[model samples]
Target: MTMVRLDDAMVLGMNGAQRRAVREALVVAYPSRGRLEALLDGLDRSLAHYAADQLPLPDAVFAVMAGAKAEGWLPLLLAEAVAVTPDNRQLADVVGDFQVGDFQVGAATTGRAPTTPPSDWAVIGALADEFPDLPAARPLISQAGLPPGRQPAWNVADAETFWSEVHRLLVDGAVVDGWPKVLLAAHRARPANPVLAAAVSAAGATGNPGWREISGRP
Candidate 1:
């Protein structure tokens, strides 16, 4: 494969093979150094490190999200790639703007000429629009979350609600919250689960300042 430099205003499109090839190059040549990049979404590798439990990544989603967040990215691009992953529980378990699995099914069926609307998608949209976006995203957000409502176009209300719900799901652990702080809080709350503590500690890179810092984890 050849390296093609992409710039802002110039969207880069890649077949799965090309994208995989590039990801391989970064993994082999840089070995987690983050030498690769994406001008729009910051870098694909960046999203891979965030440690999302439902994400089917070989890397960590938290690390990726944190890196991109640190780089001041909006996570709009990788959001598309990761939007419909197999494990996208979105928000049902954790709490956010989407339920990944349901969202994907819904998104795939949206505006279809022959397919019926995914039930979950319709439910989520109806719920999100009802209250400025919360409980709905606790399972699924992103364009998939939009469904038949002016989708593919990010709405201002959706974006704001997205961040708000993410803060709850990811940082605050309102819905399952996250592993690190929750682990810490659990420990503080008494009767903590050692398995969980050890699991979190051993699940990813430690001391990340963002997400959790288990060991060489997700």
Candidate 2:
């Protein structure tokens, strides 16, 4: 069989008016042999804009933004959730799947900062061997269910955003350990810093209905 692949936009119906408008803005709204970067900025704008009304967390919209080039311009993509299961934890494996190096969807970055840096398509159990106490580490490894590397390490990348994403996942209960008592305890004990206070509050509110507004633009 002469197999063929289908574009997510097509099946998801990005050709419609409202969506088309957003797509046209991104330029890659339709497939072409053009620079993928061209559509990235526009996609970022549309996702951010529409997210205010209805979060871009819908599968179609989420795929468009989450799958974009993450490294060169890291600011564009945010913590968009793809699905939510019965579990109280917000469904955001997509965020953990991302990498600062390769464009793979379910990649991970682990280990001490300024050292391990980042790796693509991580297996959480193996990565957890280092931290030993990171609640979310192994779950991330098992959940991503990564196969043998489709693309081997070209070289280590910055992994800055990757670290943050994983941390957010850990705090939100995406990982196995997902220590709320530890997190809340530390959060409460923090110095009476306003910024930290706000951070703590925001951290507490993830996966809430009200906060869904910018869920995709998270």
Candidate 3:
């Protein structure tokens, strides 16, 4: 299996809103400590590059750093960067907030970024189109849990089975990674299925409660 690098510039060039949406999706889909560290490191590198070149820092950088601060690593990670790149005025200004305790370290370590929310389905569809090869980019039924040789019929039986499996996976604390995209893919496949529609809706609801539950699983 080919692994996509998180720091790909093409992926990073998304407009502020889209980039934030994708980052939120990634946090929910892959909540491991290692994954979080990689993301933080990527953000650090991007910020350092922007600082080194004196390029205007993208809005997404602050947004992502805020997320890392809330995750409790921003202070430590930014401190390291601040130590290494003292001449990066922009980086110094951002890290100053953490040093002065303007931002609070969150009690919780992992979750969505606190900001304007976007439609999960729309974001998934857009990302899938924009970055089709990335594992988390496409939320196809085939990637969720469809059995081999079976196509997504979106029939009642298919809908019920799919929903049941997803519910079971979530409740059993299984690693249902990329499930949000999977649910959205199902909704797209059968827009009229109440179960799927509701699941999709719930997945994108305020604070993304459904997604939090899924991501909370081991």
**Stretches of candidate 3 above 4 Å error?**
1-141, 145-163, 176-179, 205-218
Model 3, 112-176: lDDT tens per residue? 23322233433333333222332332246445543434332334342234344444553454434
For model 3, state the Cα shift of residue 207 in Å: 7.7
Better of 1 and 3 by lDDT: 3
Error of 2 at 31 (Å): 37
Clashing pairs in 3: none
TM-score between model 3 and native: 0.22
lDDT of each: 0.31, 0.29, 0.39
The residue-by-residue lDDT of candidate 1 on 143-174, one tens digit each, is 11223332223344563344333334444433
TM-score per prediction, in order, is 0.20, 0.18, 0.22
Ten contiguous residues with the weakest lDDT in model 3: 1-10
lDDT of 1: 0.31
Q: Which stretches of candidate 2 lie over 4 Å from their true place?
A: 1-159, 171-173, 176-189, 202-218
